[model samples]
Target: ENEVVASMSANVFKVQVAVGDKVIAGQSLIVLEAMKMEIPIESPRDAEVAEILTQKGATVSTGDVLVRLK
Candidate 1:
């Protein structure tokens, strides 16, 4: 299993995938807003999304787990 984590402190702007969704490397899994800019958090490898740890509008700090995949 692999996890997608927040790279910086930010508010989750959007969630593009859900649990059980099939995903590929580089696909956007979540969007975060930091410093007034939108950042896309992407999948690291091909996998099925196993969990979403954050929701839209949630605040997250660096290294916080956002999504889990398997």
Candidate 2:
């Protein structure tokens, strides 16, 4: 299992995937907006989403725990 941390290139705006969803490597799990740009947070490997630690429109900072994968 691995913890998916949200590293914002800008600012966190929304979370897409939820716990129990099977995700492929490089899949977008969260969406972030900052500086008029949208940034996507992606899965690093094939795994099930174990936990969703943030909600839509929630602000998250760099290195914040966003999801857990198992």
Candidate 3:
């Protein structure tokens, strides 16, 4: 299983992918907000989204797993 994790502490601004969605490398999966900036979290490789571990408006910390991929 592969997982997408948060790189910094922030609030989840948007979830761009849904479960079962096929994604390509560099595809934006989630957008996080911190210090008034929008940071996009992208897929590191091509895969199908297996699960979304975080939701929009949720708060996450650095290294928190946001999505699981297969």
Candidate 4:
């Protein structure tokens, strides 16, 4: 199992994957907006998205789990 966590405080700009979606390593799973920049949160390995813990327009902090993968 793998977990994707936010790397910094930001607003969720978009969620690119849904639960049960298959993803590849380095695939963009979410987009975060902070400091006027768009930051892409990517998958670290090939896996199936098991859960999404956040949504677009939601605020998140560093280390917050955004998605769970298996």
- 1-70 per-residue lDDT for model 4 (tens digits): 3999999999999999999999999999999999999999999999999999999999999999999999
Candidate 3 lDDT by residue in tens digits, 1-70: 4999999999999999999999999999999999999999999999999999999999999999999999
Model 2: per-residue lDDT, tens digit, 1-65? 39878666446677778789999999999888888888888999999998898887777777888
Q: What is the overall TM-score of model 1 with all chains considered together?
A: 0.97
- Clash pairs detected, candidate 1: none
Give the Å shift of residue 35 in candidate 1: 1.1
TM-scores of the models, in the given order? 0.97, 0.86, 0.97, 0.97
The Cα local distance difference test for each model comes to 0.96, 0.83, 0.97, 0.97
Q: Go through the candidates in order and give the C-alpha RMSD of each one to the true structure.
A: 0.8, 1.7, 0.9, 0.8
Superposition TM-score, candidate 4 onto the true structure: 0.97
Error of 1 at 49 (Å): 0.2
Which regions of candidate 1 deviate over 4 angstroms? none
Better model by lDDT, 2 or 4?
A: 4
Candidate 2 matches the true fold with a TM-score of 0.86
| Whole-structure CA lDDT of model 4 | 0.97
